[model samples]
Target: MAPTATRSPWPRVGAIVLLLTALLSVIMIAFAWPATRSSVHDIPIAVAGPSAATAQVAQQLSAKRPGTFDVTVVDGTAAAERLILDREVYGAIDVSSGHPQLIIASAASPAVAQALQQVAQALGGTDAGVPVRDLVPLPADDPRGAGLAAGALPLVLGGIAAAGVLTSLVVGVARRLAGALAFAVTGALALVAILQFWLGSVEGSYWLNSGAVALGIAATALTILGLESLLGAAGLGLGAASMMLLGNPLSGLSSAPEMLPSGWGTLGQFLPPGAAGSLLRSTAFFDGHAAAPHVWVLLGWAALGLVLAGLAAARTARRPAAAEPAAEAVPATVAV
Candidate 1:
């Protein structure tokens, strides 16, 4: 018989190279696109002054960067400050006393604050610098909020790692899940301590901050664990990729969500990473204002993951029972 032809190694090698290239390209786009395309688009900012002055200021802002700022006219600076504290606005342009003053909440978003500062400078023309007041300043040790932004990736990676370890090392579904939860709690505590006490990135009640971090880690780890339990190795890969690629880049942790082009920012807030970052920020600085929505999102993800895990566990439990009858029949046949 004629020998069968072997497949060419070059084709397999080429395919691998192509696949790797495609993956790298996607990763680059995910991480770089948002940052490069970032710009102010309908970002909420209050204007506090008389009707005529506020209208003119609003018109100028629109003319300068059309559709950039969603200008809300308020009665006075007091009203504007309330909105900022409530997380309704990023910053405000106050012309209440016939002089423009810039009120910023740097803790909410340092990027937005810087943008507003530039706008404030422009408003002052060449005469003098605009009077600036930071309503919510970041911690003295970490004034840029670099630590807080940098902390987001580690949390995501830690949760992914937790899921991997539990799935691989733990024997039963219940045990794996318990381990994941325990890791979430302990990991959150450790991370929060480092960020809060050591790095000075986070502020507010320690317990509250720890709780936020724990919930975020739990939501991520449980979701990944559920996927792994249900679909095995493939499920784990899917979960990890989704969290890293789709969730992390769109998280808006490094910058305000509104800064992202299109509606991706809003969509990010619905995902685990984004929700976690926003929730943590709120708890740390805003006293939990505007935190309910993010809390619900995380809870929803965790609940769904639990349901998936239960289904997988049920399936695993049934396999042994189904196999028992076949084994018993095998002994009878062997005796015959």
Candidate 2:
């Protein structure tokens, strides 16, 4: 023992430093890339007027922004309004009167509304007013959508935190599942109360909003819980990392999915965070219109989590039974 050489700590220290550096780089990219690169891409908008005028306007939009807007040409402003109300489009350019008027749904996305207003101003000439109409206005209290934007990250964090606690402290798979679900339901209700009543961050049916929030929380917590059950502590890290790093940033809660660069936005919609945000908005502002897709995405994730958790639980149960049989056999052999 006295002659044994001591292991160098520098190697371990260097490895940790390198690992931290890599993690930092990844974190920076995940968050910064979305914010910096956020711009309109294939954002659906309607152009209402005669075919010739609408075509010309659409062509100008295409030429000016180039692939930014997906223009839906409608004969009348009424049709364009219908599209916005149905959640089919973000905003509309009503050129039906030969003068361009921008109809935007601020509740759908303040950022998109602002951007459309700017485009309208440019189209109508800066010297004249753009004649903007907010079809779906955000709550007066949270006019800028700051509350909803700020709330997105917390929802992800809350689910992760609940799952972590359950994994560490709760015993039995059934108990863990029960605890996560209880938290999701109760926590969502409480959070929604704050957002809707206190902060005015949301509108529409309170229970519906709570349900949407609960579903999102359940999806995240259950998925992480199942991962931990199967892969031990590493599973927790993987799940949390993916949710916080990938899901939260790409959620597009601050703006709109189409604002994110190309495919990333669509990818985010499949994740818990993005699905949750979209679902919440639909419930809050759009009367649950276009909510079926987000609901399905969440359901799929939650189902996957349940299947994984059940498999892990079955494996765990088998281990104890197998050990018991082996122990009994060993005792009998020794006695004989």
Candidate 3:
């Protein structure tokens, strides 16, 4: 050990900066690219008319954009409307009339509705325009979908913030959980007051919307907290990455799941953000018709998070006092 090699701290610091820069770049690219390149992928639309007309319309649409529209043939307009309300299809075309009529659920997605309008117009030709009707229109107050689209980000940020605060301020699993729950309830109420009452963005039963928001916040916060408890710093990083990188863009809030790049949309629905968005939409517009699954998803995440936190606490409590000495010895050896 006559000539010990001394490593400069600058190199380590520079490498960390470079690595972080690269990571940020990757994240930015990953999120931006998919959103910019978004196109209709297997969007479900029904054709309600005679068998011949239905087949003709379906074939024509398929010809225009191969694999873009999943055209289902229904007996008549009533059947199509039923499907739309049931959340089976986004829009439906009634070729039963001389001029085609497009029925859309704007509550589902205005962008998709516009796209369907374009398709219907194209089919009907320039002279005979396709008459478009919105079955489930968006709220008069929030017609542009700005509110619904913007909802997910706040919830995501709120969850992360809640987790960060609770982890730093509170100790013990039970206390952390209680903090998360408290934050969720209060946060939901506050958000509802701002976005729903003041801004008039969110429209629905106040209690239902608030409850949905609370569940979403609780699920997100508890999940992050659980991960932190179980895996320490690494767990927090993982949770953040999952929510930001994978969950955010794939959420399908601005568009329907079918509008996203195939499997990615479906994948997003399994996450808390997507589930939350869907649940909120259902509650707001569909009168909670298709909200059970989304509710279950949120509940499942909350349950799992609680379980994980409990296990982590129990494990920490059970560790022997002698193990602390051994753990300290290992770190000392590593430093040497």
Candidate 1 residue lDDT tens string, 166-208: 8888888789889988998999999999999999999998888
lDDT of 2 by residue, 122-177 (tens): 88866886799999999999999999999898899988999999988989888998
TM-scores for all predictions: 0.93, 0.94, 0.90
The TM-score of candidate 1 is 0.93
RMSD to the true structure for each prediction, in A, is 3.2, 2.4, 5.8
Cα lDDT over the full model 1:
0.92
Candidate 3: residue pairs that collide: none
Q: Which scores greater on lDDT, model 1 or model 3?
A: 1
Better of 1 and 2 by lDDT: 2
- For every model shown, the clashing-pair count is 0, 0, 0
Clash pairs for candidate 1: none
Q: Model 3 segments beyond 4 Å from truth?
A: 1-8, 321-336
Q: What ordering of candidates by lDDT runs from best to worst?
A: 2, 1, 3
Scored against the true structure, residue 254 in model 3 reaches a CA lDDT of: 84
Candidate 3 lDDT trough over 10 residues, lowest sum: 327-336
Model 2: worst 10 consecutive residues (lDDT sum): 327-336
* TM-score result, candidate 3: 0.90
